[model samples]
Target: MAASSTTLTLRERWTRFVDEEMSTFVFSTGVYAAAICAKEYKELQPTPQRMQQALRKTGAKMPLITLSCAIGIAGMKMCILGVSRLREDYTRSSVLVACPVAGALLRAHRGPRAMAIGALSFGALGYGSDYLFSMWHRRNADAEEVRYALSLREHHNVHHNDAFFIETLQSNAYLLEASQK
Candidate 1:
């Protein structure tokens, strides 16, 4: 049982790692391709030869962009996971710990000032994203719980007014708060 559970955890972690890596790769590639197309549109002559050059340039650059994104995101995920393991909990703190390191690495080639800016920017983004996601999940869970309780109450009543019951559920404070966006 212990062995199986350990294997399951390892598998899940590997899945998460690969998922992040692949998603980052795909997203970066698409964005880069779009940027390349836009640049070609603005700068290149509208000729078959120019179009071919644009295609060739995109093909040449895509692998580099894809690899960079995949490796960078993978490294960031590893840092987050390592922090979570050390802290014995997965929380926003893990993102806070990882984002700066990832950001620093991202701008290291540009020297100290750029690296500092990147770290600060990435840290802020990570903090904001984590906070928003946590709040969103909490609201969703609260709304779901309210719905379940209301449903159970509905099932127990023999002569309840359907319209009134629905109105009551809709007016629930949790649901109201959740609905506020």
Candidate 2:
């Protein structure tokens, strides 16, 4: 009876930890989405030149962003490991949680019913965990690297311009063909 109680206590603690971590992950993803939206909004504003200049200076913020990404990745890895262990130890409950969570993490888009359920479930479980983990890792390792990454993102955005895309496509084709053996 004592052993059983200890086991139950351990399981409860694990569940609580998972729940908290998952919540943090979700929050981080929401932040990332918000950041992306803000970038888009800045691009659309009348004073986009200032925004563009700021983006060009993003190299200064690289460390923060990189650390965050690293943390997010680590968190996701931990979540996967925890879920796998839980599934092996407690098949039914783990299935109930892990299946949907795994599906969502993978962004699986199968049939309508499965997709809808998986998306909603995974959205809830996987949340922004990955993003947060990665971001945290990047921030800790190289604060300045984030600025460069942001600049890269900005450059990529400009690549979406029709003229730029056309030019890039032509150039890429030439390079690819030229490099062929």
Candidate 3:
């Protein structure tokens, strides 16, 4: 969800776009496929005729599932991307905006109430996910910074007499202390 940067080559952008879209679509398809399998197993017998009918039903549904998943996932991602770009940063608000659009698309056929419920549910999920992810990233970054600082301190200790190394270590320590505050 990083903002698209000017440094990204056209090829890199295209690759990222394809990778994100395809992965989401594949995941959606897999979930739907599993749901279909469960439904078939629960409702039908194992007889050859029943199995054949199930197979036909599966075959007919697969294409629609694939197409709908691909389109739906792509639409959601595109909306998120657009919102992120417009906001000039990847934030929970961007996801908050995008999820309602996706929810409306998903539940529009059900009626306004369904759409509103879907939008509220999806928006809450998206916002919570974004918040949790950001928290995780922040924690990881802090740990990494601490690790780097420790490594630098170890190096400085080994080169105890090196003024520049000692000075650099002290500066890093000061920065770390400031950050913790």
Steric overlap count per candidate: 0, 36, 0
Q: Which candidate is the best by TM-score?
A: 1
Q: Give one digit per residue, the lDDT tens place, for model 2 in 81-159.
A: 6876855564334433443454443333234575467557665554466556656665544433444444554677764
lDDT of 1 by residue, 1-181 (tens): 4666446587787887676566676776687577776566534466877778777777876765565455556668789889999999998678788998777665555578977897898888888888888888878777776787587776777455767666666667646585556
After superposition of all CA atoms, the RMSD between model 1 and the true structure is 6.8
Off by over 4 Å in 3: 1-23, 36-71, 74-78, 81-96, 158-181
Better of 1 and 2 by TM-score: 1
TM-scores of all candidate predictions against the true structure: 0.54, 0.28, 0.51
Ranking by TM-score: 1, 3, 2
CA displacement after TM-score superposition, residue 2 of candidate 2 (Å) = 39
How many angstroms is residue 82 displaced in model 3 relative to the true structure, after the best TM-score fit? Answer: 4.6
- Candidate 2 local distance difference test against the native: 0.53
What's the residue-level lDDT of 126 in candidate 2? Answer: 43
How much does candidate 1 score in TM-score?
Answer: 0.54
Show where candidate 2 strays beyond 4 Å: 1-48, 89-181
**Which stretches in model 1 have alpha-carbon errors above 4 Å?**
1-71, 74-78, 89-92, 158-175, 178-181
